[model samples]
Target: MLAGLQNVTFEFGARTIVEDATWHIHPNERIGLIGYNGTGKSTLLKLFAGEYAPSAGTVERSRSTSIGYLHQDLLSFDTNESILQVALHAFDKAKKIERELEEITKKLEEHTTDELLHAYSEKLHEYEEAGGYTIEHRTEEVLQGLGFSNSDLKRPYREFSGGWRMRVLLAKMILQQPDLLLLDEPTNHLDLPSIEWLEKYLQHYKGAVIIVSHDKYFLNRMVKKIVELYQRELHIYNGNYDFYEVEKQQRVELQQRAFENQQDYIRQQERFVERFKAKASKAAQAQSIQKRLDKLDRIEDVTIERPNIKINFNVDKTPGRVLVELKHVSKHFKNIDILEDASAEIDRGDKIALIGANGKGKSTLLRILAGAEPFEGERKWGHNVDDAFYAQHQLEALNINNTILDEMKEAGSKKTELELRTLLGCFLFSGDDADKKIKVLSGGEKARVALAKTMISKANFLLLDEPTNHLDIHSNELLIDALNRYQGSLILVSHDRYFISKTANKIWEIVDKKIKVFKGTYEEWVEWKERAESRNQTLASGSAPVKEVIKETPKASSNGQPTTSTGGANAPINKEAQKELQKQQKMFQQLEKQLADLNKQKAELEAELSNPSTYADPEAFKKTENAYRQVKDKLASVNADYEKVFEKIMTLEEQQS
Candidate 1:
């Protein structure tokens, strides 16, 4: 075991995070530690990291084990060194050996002795063993993988923002390759591509990993096991997040059933005991029954663990056909070009998900749309378009001295106190929580409050950036449900794939200083992207793009009724197709036979060209090479023709069906 807890109990003052919880960490296990926000997920990670001691039981670890913990607190590490240098520090032994090696080289240049030479040789070997020669290369690779540019690598680490700083620390943690890795909300600081990169990296990671994240998609794809902290206990699920969801529901249902049955039995026994206690003969029996009832291990009734709050968005105004339009939009920051001559439109019902890697200007473009940032662009809002923008920075707009309820009142939403309190409850501020001053709220709480304010704005258009970052999985579901029922248009920037999939009907991505639009759902967009990649790979392999063949069919009637080729004939079309289909089928078969023959000839010629003995005979070799080139060209030609005919047949078959 790298590190684990055995019947551990943890508490903060009077609040118990966990009680008698046992979880063993094995090598190479990819685990997702999950729970609702404020459920002490981070505190649990700290327990494993030795940042906090368990109130009871033991935290065990192997003597040789090394751990790497990546959390938001690591952002406090200020450094002027280049990010590359900071990442290279992961190689502690290699760096120390490198310093000794440098000193030895300088000393050897002035005075050479057998002892000095011997020491230098020994240090060189140690450096090599410690991967000293390739440390910089490895560090650069890891940094770039986490979304750092080559130029950014040389900049001072302190120059980067919090998110970037977190990424740099993450890269260092990854490079350290400890026996066990603990990450708290790692995806919170990453973009879609970086999250994907981290997922891929962790999938094949040599060490055990335990991630505390709210990203359902990330946890589903990245972890093989899930550990949920709930009700002062650790519940283990031997599968990914999706599996855990199903299993947890089933467990809840079963537990509820057991509790109901046990309650019924106790009630029946109580009634019998009351009826019999009055009789002298049955008094002893009633007493024994009472003792048995008292001694019985009772099952607690099932209750909802997550907050049960409804989120409903009401659009007060109906916008015009086009809610917002960007005409020849262009944005530039210093020497960096974000968008140039980009034109796009958000229609009245459009639900757009703007997604891509970080530094690709997603948030910047959102600001441009909100008119909060200066850029060279034409942003036009349609008639009756009342827009509300919510972002992380918008949290600053809250009045620190005001309570959460007061802050909502200042939104000018005109909601009654009960109504506003209900809204706050939706954001996890229930009962007296709304009375707490904003200054006492954590960053996540502030973000949630800001989101709730935007939701209650009664706007016809909404711009949300990272709305799910501060929300737990269940809260995200509530938000998705709210957005699904929303009657307004929205353009949101988010890295959560599950959120996007659930809420978006359109996708927008910034590509090479242009906004590329895809009129489809997130799932469809992903499938299209995969197909495009596959086609690109085919092109790289010297294959032309498949040519789609089109055939004109009988047009439908003006009233949208089906039309037949054989004018009003009572033909099933199946019969007609079967008759004409034979000819096409014959041609298709002939083409396949011809294609096979050509491939066989090409293979034979290529084999002959590959033989060394054939090269010894110049004339034969030249003839073989010529034949091979001819066959290769012929193969490409035939392949295209084959696809065209294949598509033609498929079209014909589908139409008949």
Candidate 2:
């Protein structure tokens, strides 16, 4: 085991957070730690990280086992140091060996002693083994994968935002390659691409990993086992998040049945003792029954509290066919252009999901659509379309001095006290909880309040940005169900794939300063993207080219459903189109070959130029350099042509479909 807790009991003063929780983290295990907010998930991680000593029992870590922990709050970095310098610190041991080798080399230059030479050789070997020479290259690759550019790497860490800084810290942790890695919501700040990159990295990671995350899709992809903290105890599941859900439900049901049966038996015995205890003839027997009843161990009922909040969008009226429309919209922040000429029409009942990388205008687009932000172009709302926008930052707009009930009353003044209380109860605010001051509420509680306000707005159209951000899994499920049952239209921006898949039918992907609309679910979009990538890879590697099959489109039946073609009427193929496709495929193959040959020549020239002997001959060096430059130019030209051809092929295929 890399680390484990032995009957760990932790508490603050009188209140207990965890009690006798024993958990063992084994080698090469990807374990996900899940629990509701304030359930000691983070505190448990700290105990494993040695940042906290268990109040009772012990936390045991194997001897000399290196642990790397990435907290939700990123560590501060040196303002004077560049991003690259901070990342390089992960290879401290390798750098130290490199420094020692440099000193030994200087000493050898002064006097060729055997001891100095031997020391230099040993240090050089150590440096190579530690990957000292290629540390900068690896750092660059990791930073780029984490959404950093070469220019960004040269800038100081303070130049980046908090979310970007978190990515840098995550990169450092991965590069350090400890024996065990403990990550707390690592995907919280990462965009889709960065999340995918991190997933691949962790899949190949040679260490045990324990993560606490609410991203169901991420947990499903990264973890093989789940350790859930519920009711101040640990429940281990031997499968992924989806599997755990099914298994947990079954276990709860079984436990509830067993508890009910035990309760029935106890009640019967109690009734028999109560009736006979007063009778003189059976007094001894009644005493024996009382003793047996007292000795019986009571079984607690299996009760999991679901979120009390009922989120139902109050749709007063249906809007026109087109709920909203944007025409040539463009948004710019100082020198950075986020959206350019983005135009789209949102019809009634269109459940659209806005997705993109961080700072890529997903939220900005939502703000623009909600008429809360200014843009360069026209935005129009359809007739009778009343819109309510739920920005993630809206939690800050809540009245801190007011109570939860007061805040809800402000948004929903028309709601009666009983109705409002019922609504608050659904959101887990009942009686005393409803009277709690907003200033004293936790982040998750504030989020819940904000969401309840939005749901009570009774708007026909909803624009939600990161609605699931601070929600626990159960709350997320409740929100998802609410959205699914919502009769009004919605445009949501969230990183939770599972929630999106369950709610969105249309996808508005903001990429490269433009919005691309796809008429399908998120899963369909993923499949299409994967197919496109596969085709691109085929083109790049000069693999077997995709054949252009001129099959007739299937005809619809009387019911307007597509029917399978078996000796059915064949549609005539356009001969010219067929020839053009073949020509394009052949050209793509030729360009791939040319690019491969040019790369080969370039590599050979680079190798020759690296040799010291080549520099001894000036003419040979000049010739090799010129040849290398020519090949490099040729390779670039071929790559450009190849990209154009590949795009053309993809377009044609898309059109055919």
Report the number of the highest-lDDT candidate. 1
For candidate 2, give the lDDT. Answer: 0.80
Candidate 1, residues 1-657, lDDT tens digits: the string is 788999999989999999999999999999999887778999999998889999999999898999999998888899899999888889988999989977976776676666776676677667767776567867887888889987899999999999999999998898899999999999998898888888888888999999998888999998989999988999999999999999999999999999999999999999999999999999999999999999999998888875567777777888899988888989988878999998888898999999999988999999989999987869997899999999998888989999999989998888799999877766778789999999999999999999999998899999999999888887888899899999999999999999999999888888768787777788887876675455433432223322211122222333211212222222245555544545555666677788899988976875564444554444564587678778778866876777776666555544442
Q: Cα lDDT of all candidates, in order?
A: 0.82, 0.80
**Number of clashes in model 1?**
0
Clash totals for all candidate models? 0, 4
Off by over 4 Å in 2: 75-78, 278-281, 307-309, 394-396, 418-433, 439-447, 542-657
lDDT per residue as tens, model 2, 402-504: 9999998999548887888777765656678898999999877898788789988889899998887777787778788888999999999988888899999
What is the C-alpha local distance difference test score of candidate 1? Answer: 0.82
TM-score, cand. 2: 0.84
Query: Relative to the unseen true structure, what is the C-alpha lDDT of residue 153 in candidate 2, on a scale of 0 to 100?
Result: 92
lDDT measured at residue 19 in model 2 versus the true structure, 0 to 100: 95
Candidate 1 deviant stretches above 4 angstroms: 104-121, 543-657
